[model samples]
Target chain A: MSHASGPPPEDRIREDHRRAVEGAPDGGRDTTPAVGRRGGPALWRRAVEGSPVALARQAFKDARWSYLYKDDTSYRVRNGADANERIQAAARRMRGSTEIPEGVDANGPFINAPVWTWEVPAYFFLGGVATGSSFVALAADLAGDERSAAIARKVTIAAIGPGAPLLVLDLGRPARFLNMMRIFKPRSAMNAGAWCLMAFSTAGGAAVAADVLGRRRVAKVLGAQTALLGTYLGSYTGVLLASTAVPIWARSRLFLPPIFVCTAVATGAATNRLVLAATGMPSGHPTRDALGTIETVAMGAELALSSFNEKRLGQLADVLEHGRAGRLFEFARWAVRAGLMLRFTRGRFAWEHHVASGLYLAGGLAFRFAWIEAGKASAGDDEAVARMARGKATVKDRLRDGRTTARVRTSARHPGRDARAARVYADAVRRLSLAIEGVLRRG
Target chain B: MTEIAIDRPESRRMGFFTDTTVCIGCKACEVACKQWNDLPADGAVFRKTSSYDHTGSLSASTWRHVRFVEQTEPVPLPDLPAYGGGNGGHGEVDLVAAAEAHGVPQMDRWLFMSDVCKHCTNAGCLDACPTGALIRTEFETVIVQPDVCNGCGYCVPSCPFGVINRDPYDGRAAKCTLCYDRLEDGLEPACAKSCPTDSILFGPYDELVETAKGRVLALHERGVTDAYLYGAGDEPGEQLAGELGAFFLLTAPPERFGLPAQAESPAQENGPVATAAGLAAAALGLAAAVGAFARAHRR
Candidate 1:
């Protein structure tokens, strides 16, 4: 019926006119001809109106819209429920394939997980052991007490056993840990440290072993030698972190090493006190009191140094303020406070003081853990790295601009445009090439 | 034996002018140092993914470190590409265009600076060290004595720039000696010698200062208003005021390059606080111990 006699030409024209006007730009001219000129609405249809590609493209667009807006997935399975529920679920499903969950092996490959060097923790442990042993020795020497010396020897031996293992374990190849002693390279702190530990450990172990074997006279002689070597062993851990190129570590070098030394002493004192208490040694013993005093001093120094360094680091202070480092620092602070409280109240609360000493020991270990963690945190972040890169680029850009300006200034004095231009261009090209090459190579 | 005058100021002081402006972040200085010193390649294997720096921070093996920094700016110039392309690459020529085309609000810029031991005038590391491990050489450069270091690592935190580090393997503090061996032979440091752009300039302390001043003036004249010399003036202390052994002509704030703008002495900062705390703790402990002894005697 429509083919023979559709609506009146005027009626069809009005309907078509409304559709065209709806699609036109509000402020633009209407360029479509009257529907009457084409005879009817059917006359306005194009030859490619039913093209499959066009329909597919529209279908793709609809599917993309659903996929982007809705989280519906393509996979479907029976839920042992109603069919109506299934249909509803299917309707909700987005047209595109679902993204595989992360960590699912069947999904796809992912970036290799990052493995941080364990050397940081090893450094922390060794430094702690060495410093702690030194404090014991220092207290013993100051008090003219032989028992303290005995305790110091014991602490030093313990330090060597655990500290040495940690240091070796930190090596990429544990077997190669011994290779550090192959040569005496002065430029390498680790090489120097390996030798120091070897000598100190050997001497300390001899003193400790002799004492254990009931050779009091020999032990005394060996103890003195151990003390001499132990001081160096304890102190060097501080310098080890300082000698590096990491800005955060290097900038805080002066304080970091000292802090480590002080921390070690505190840890050693706490450990000895805990041992004395567990062994039922008399409370308020002069040696125990002296050890506590040494621990208190060392803890104070370590806390103060860490706090000062963090404050001075400014934006970089995030390493100590947040994440795992922040947690470590928090625990360390708690331990230090508990230790100080116990030491202060030692006369009033003897058993409580021992408990506090235990806390102090925990705190010291935590401090080392936190310090190492923070240092690693500092190295892992992108903000610091990006900041450093930008600083270098700024300097480089200025230098390049300066050189170019200098060349232009020099070339301006020349008479010939060709020669001056050639010189300037060549110089610019050379400089640019070098700059680019440098960036690429660095990357 | 003839004795040197203690009060008379030393005339010849060696120094380093790490231009930072021209540093390519190659870390050649670090590698060259280990090679020249015959140091072990310990931390070299730890490739840091956060930045181009793989060795993380300075350690026993790495004496000279080149730090890489990235910064962002609001204005985008079409001429500068994010990653610098090669000499003949189209990216090189169209860097400016690409930057402009992106029309992004923030654009990143890179910085590279090779850092080394400051070898300061006061040398806090030397002052704080108990074993006399850290010492000022005849060349006026601070060096850690490996034999004497005792692994105390006091010098590590004593340094304001954190340049000194102790080796984990040997337990000794180590750092750049300004290639003291090379200096002894009247040769420049391996870093300065190998630097293609002369970014790591090695010279007499006074001459470098003067040259740095002249360069700063030249930069200002060329409209590089941000250029300034750090650790060159006498603001922080009289000792550091005259010149820095390892100074820098920085384009931005020194902190951007991880160098504090004002010199911070770690020993000075912590000294009084630590001392006060130590004294207080000692007094409290002694008082408690004495009271405990008296009570025990009474019992």
Candidate 2:
């Protein structure tokens, strides 16, 4: 395959081949090529004289060539001088006879390209808004404080306003957004998401409107709906990521949904606290106390779950614990710590400690962005795939070994009358042993 | 008089099986998704430099995403003794030495997977939406009700795949609906129908899972042993009751596919923790306030 590369150091090639074939069954008996001169198999005649390294290399090359030109079938018949020549010949055959093809270049035609476009940052932003708003709503509802509840409702509505538009704009055809409700397919995540968003928004808006209109009864009904809708809205993002084919995201799928919910709750709590402080809510107000508690607990769960996810998925840990994601994680940690400290602190600092709440909000949003970015990065890499392949191989090898050993033991116990039975059993054992050896040696 | 009943037929469910083994990494599914749904063409300005996958990740506009990965390893091609050479391949190709001589990069493998929204059995987005905008279809696919959405981004955070997003321009939550209109019309989804490689096979949920298991077994039988299914066969929690509507056959660990092998519901798991922490903080703050008030009164 080398282009005038001066026949690549013959000694190195020979040495490699020798090393590869060192423990062949034939054991250096017949010093000849595995294939006969007439391009035919010579398995029985040769005792593995050819270099194993060369053999392995040839096998891989043959596999690639065969796979590439399998459809043509006839390409193998017309042998070329080298692998590249064969590939070129196969490509030529596949393209069909052409004379000065117009608009065709050496690089081949751009047959199919991706038409879909995903705005990564937009996903992060929308998630943050949704979760942040949910936290505020939850804290407000729990505390039974009208002022806090109104602010929470407003925040939730505002967050959704920006979030919904971004989602629709992301679609190549924004006009068809309404088609999502034409029919409900329970299996489709988008369908469910549409309903969730509608319910949450309506309840939230109704609640807010009722509060503005001074209708306590209407507000109470809407508030209940808002809480229900908010719960699903805060948690579904996890299911969405888990449902995809990206390894990193899929592996930690279960963990993400709950984490997102917690993060949202934490963020919402921070926002609620900030709003309350700004509005000069009394220091010992139940609403303030509830928001502080939610913030501290939510932050703790978020950090703990994230840590658990990282520990459970080893090499995959690189996504969150290393790179830019690690920085985000650190920031989130600091925010949580500060929020907790502020929430627990007493006296003068308690009344003036909205700084920690602000930090939590910022940190929560940053964490959401970090996760989205990390998932994107994780999906873009190949090392994770290779590692999975290796893991599968190990499992398969173990199963095969166990099966072989069981068969050998069963045969031994049977004690068949004929010597052939014994010989067959012995051969099976030998093959199994060799296979085990191979695996060990390779490892 | 009316009869009360439970376990409706509509609740039984349907799903998708995405076989990544044969995926050619062609984003035909992604294109078909946008076209069939009449979604706006997600603008073409973005570029994901890491791989050929320019779509980046799933979003409202791009409901389907194709991921590309490249892996490298030192592997020697088999020598062709059948040709007219000596011990090495015909004419002594010396692939390794030749590779070194030509300064070729080390051997590498490429893997490509097309990602889409996972309509979980227990969808967090569906659980978290306070506006009732997101709902489960009769077919069990999760969808967003655009008209009622009111742009509450709650569903965005609730999704695990990060698949759903609000269109920056239109203010509505959006993501894949598995072509619900087509399904109603007795047709396969556009993405599954358009997949040339049969990589994204569409069928009854049960059959797909069976087929996936068979394929994984076949791959194991062959030398390509690193094959497994994700989001199938296990119901972890009440929040996640059934298997996924969309599942995948991956060559790597679940994480590599951006999925959690052991799925958990973030909302359910963290809700209590967050609530507890909030209560604790509130108690402490209240105690401090009461103590300060007493001190002032005593003075």
Candidate 3:
């Protein structure tokens, strides 16, 4: 064998023959010996001999083959079948029922897990805050509240400082993030959002710089421009999510954007309220009260809209009420509730207002995290995806009055065992809404 | 059986017509695809639950995957030893023979489907791509330019079928190109060529659809009434935006093969609705802010 320690006797003899040929007068012309001098067979002959078919043929020729191992597996041999006879038999058996086979898990085949992690939600939160702050700045400037406007402009700049970096960090190729600007695609929400973010950041920076430089006219114009772009920035993250095949996000198409915007406005106003209060703004100052009122309304709307959409999501809504997303959402709900409570019960103490603002901001940020986490979970849910594909998950389906399709049959492998949990969930939402109503009435 | 001719002046829209019924759970196509594409193996994962499907689903490295859905009824544990004794040396129960001999009910079955990228008419990944990395070839198949993809991962969630994915090693999104290189040389895709039963057919798009329809009809005539074409039609105002370049003739529902029956490109409907809603909310917030500030100023 070629794998042996030394050349075989035949190769050794051929080498001696080649040396003899070289020593002889006419042997130099004889190339045959030179061809045989190699340790193994010729390349072509070796290739042919080494081929699997050749080896198998040789094996069969040597009487090594039997019915037990006649190029078929032991399973096939035992079944006494040939050419997919077993599979054909199975296929024939399956024709009796349309129901999917028991214990056959379909979820294993779906690979639509969300790639976006914490950085994406973090970026979304930051962008929303920046946009919100910019809007506040614009509103304050327009209302002739220069001091509030100045503070909001500073907040806008600070909030947007890490927006692009965080977004780039989230990319699979961080260095290639600039490629996002290579094309102008308005149809793609991510593309539009990227451009809006860049533009908003630029306008915000310029507005802040102009304000510092005493360029009042330039600052106002730029502030207005910043706010305009901020509007897109505040809600485009939701659009980005909605424009994906992720079931929960796509189904909440009409609501996600508005919900995001409400949070942005709430968080922005909350930040302003906290900043003003921290600067020793007297209790019930006109600007502080306005900011608080704006924060309260926006936070309230965000809570209501999210609850409505969560209900609309049907069975798919389990993503939001369970898992990591569920925990985060639970925290956000309490934070918003506490914030609203504090806002309603305004005391003489400035710390009370600061706590309320802090709670609103925390709630808004947590909502973003919860939504993103839920989206990740939603993408992996095969039944939810199937439901989405069947036009049963979206409001568009209801508008078309789609035929009431049967719910996906649950199995031991799949998730859908939450009837009692769902009841508790509904009760909680009902009680929460009632509490919100009572708070509003008392206020 | 349309022969793939080598000498053609121009490329016609060609695609795969995967008939799942005739598939025999053999993973020859998957092997051929991996060998031809020089794709990295998804390192040893012994999946005890998913019968013979260790690779799981189609992903960046795995362009073609054979999905094994075992529908066989649970055989009694006591019958197992008896079948082994009857079968002699190998000591394995002959499940098919047992079912055929009425030892087990004939309702037991196994379904095999080889899944690949759908290559939708209005591909969500292509539309949602911000870098213009994804493009439609002359054959009407969507391809991602590796050099252009910045790995923004927008296309990852954009795919309705979850075929495209970013490679963990490089972070660049990768998927089946329908063997673009092979097609350019007038060769059939590796997966189609390797399919032993002609389960994965390759030909002109229109011809393939007709052939698939005929195959379904033929199956129906053969008493396989469940056989139907998925991603074959352009239903007006339906969720499926348009026809799939690579479609399937399935015996079970699309979801059984991890395919969405009524997938839509989010760009067409969802994108617009979201943007409109966002704009409206922004306007509302802006107005609210202005009004609130005005009231504060008066105070």
Candidate 4:
């Protein structure tokens, strides 16, 4: 094994490498022996080998023994044995239908799914719609579109009417709702969300209450304030999801909130359109046309943003694209697309508009519910989480090892660096440390 | 208002650096935790699971958990020393014949890990708590003030590791306190104290990191190249050592232990979302302003 290797010759070095090449014009000769030559990226590449994902994937492929049937574990099996054999064997040994099989444990550990159940998602949906509607109400009121304003305000009030109760219900007790107000930590998304929810409901309810009382000026003032609170209300739920360790949520932290905010606007506009159609608002009316346009554009923005976010999320994107989340996500996407297509085909007066508006409303709620489902799936899949942390595979590694972690630093053996230079560097470091200590003492 | 300072402490952070390689799958730490904390029973029945573990996970009731992860891979032909061996310790086993005779196609690599709250520097529970309930103690450990918790369940989904949980009966969020009370008495946490194999080591957070790294290096020298320390480096988002008060020297990927791959605490989410909301609100406000301007000029 001839180990004589040193820095590359001048001819072998590219312009970038030329600067570091010992014999190049810009560099000095190291004169190190061949065995101790410091060289290129091969050393660095070897250092970064075997990331957790690659290790796990290797183990998975190497698995030759799998239980005969579907369960969480791999059992030793002959080449052609049925995969469910383990489950079958366990079942046979069990007493009856009432007895559960030990092989059921093969599905692996019971990942504690997100404890936030139906009430939480329902609250997210209601709050998003309410926030969306508040903006519509404020804009319409400001533009002096009294008819549209009145309808929008009614939708906002109606959505929020049950929102407070849903939030309390999700907390399990009435006291928990009050506990949310015990402290204000502005930096905390949860704290900010709670405060914003409270403000939005109070201001939105007040605006509608003023409208009911025939106080137009007071209603308009409170409506604007409600929109102000709605800004955070519409977007914070997405932030809440993104803040967790959930792979799907954490992977696209920057864009999830934007996607949520845009969707909120779409849902709000759709709610107004539905309310207007129910109240007999004319399709030819400019206010109705404007709301449809807003809904279409907002849905478009939401779609574009989330697609980009998903792409950036890499492996974690599967969290949103698989299982129950996948079905719901597909339906929501189709609903948004259909809703937009309906606007181009017909005016708001057409029956298609009413259906499309309902689709838009349903799509928004579906998206929230789907997002939570996706989070649960991501939590369950250990491999997906590992891949996400290691990041998307590069072209070369993706096919092979898939184990390239961030740093690949390798210790290059430098031949006896004329001892004088090393001695000087060591002396300097020692002196520097002592100097810093003296400075600290003097201060 | 609950005060939330998301910064890591300047003082020495006391923590546990669990070396999973040395673990012997003992439940002593779990028992010690329950005894010291006076926690209610999570039951001793053999729950059907993918592995030998009966305690499924960390919860409000059960603070310490041991995971039994079984990988379906053949061991190397020339077996190296098992973890925590190699020093006058011989653990060589010729299982090739045993594996094939059993009708098993390949070898089995069963790994066990003792799981606990990471006591993350950017803890989601501490950041999300609205009632001043979850707070970082002076030791840089996170502890939930049970009496202060209102059980809003915000802290439940907020935790990246799902370590903090709300009990159904108690209706309050709770989790491992890292034995803050014991630490105050100059005693190590119960779990670490009871760990027979020294798998779980408690010390200054930085010191434990060095020790863990050295152990991983030693394992590598013995030809166990797969041995690695998780949560010890600057792997961002919910990682230990780099961002957690409690880190681990894991023999496998963290997710295999049910830990999140990318964990961003609640506090980390605020900046980006707030920016998006700000920009969106500004745009909407501008649109509303233009509409108001148009209405005023229409006359």
* Candidate No. with top TM-score: 3
Task: State the fnat of model 3.
Answer: 0.43
Question: Highest DockQ among the candidates is held by which one?
Answer: 3
What is the descending lDDT order? 3, 4, 2, 1
Candidate 2 per-residue lDDT over residues A118-195, each given as its tens digit: 442345445545545554554344444556667777777776766666665554334434544544433334456567
- Per-residue lDDT over A255-370 for candidate 4, one digit per residue giving the tens place of the 0 to 100 score: 77777877788888888887887788767566766677677777888888878777766656776787999999999999888887886785545888888888888888889899
- Candidate 3 lDDT over residue span A142-169, tens digit each: 8898888888998999999998998887
Stretches off by above 4 angstroms in model 1 are A1-443, B1-11, B22-59, B70-109, B168-171, B236-243, B296-299
> What share of the reference contacts survives in each candidate?
0.00, 0.00, 0.43, 0.16
lDDT of 1 by residue, A369-442 (tens): 77666755664553442332222212222111222221100000112344556445534543453354346547
lDDT of predicted model 2: 0.54
TM-score, candidate 2, chain B alone: 0.80
TM-score of candidate 2 on Cα atoms, chains taken together: 0.45
After superposing candidate 4 on the true structure, give the runs of residues whose Cα lies further than 4 Å from its correct spot: A1-112, A172-174, A212-214, A306-315, A347-350, A393-443, B1-12, B44-50, B71-109, B206-228, B233-241, B253-256, B259-266, B269-299
Q: Which of the two candidates, 2 or 4, achieves a greater lDDT against the reference?
A: 4
Question: Candidate 1: fnat, from 0 to 1?
Answer: 0.00
C-alpha TM-scores of all predictions: 0.46, 0.45, 0.76, 0.68
* Candidate 3 residue-wise lDDT, B1-299, digit = tens: 01121223355778888888668878999989877776655555668775666878888778898888776665332222222224444666666556558755536567888889887777888878887667777677788876567678888888888899876655678888898866655567888877877788877787666666555544554456566677763333442446778887777666677776566566655777778899999989988988898898797
Q: DockQ, in order, for the candidates?
A: 0.02, 0.03, 0.24, 0.08
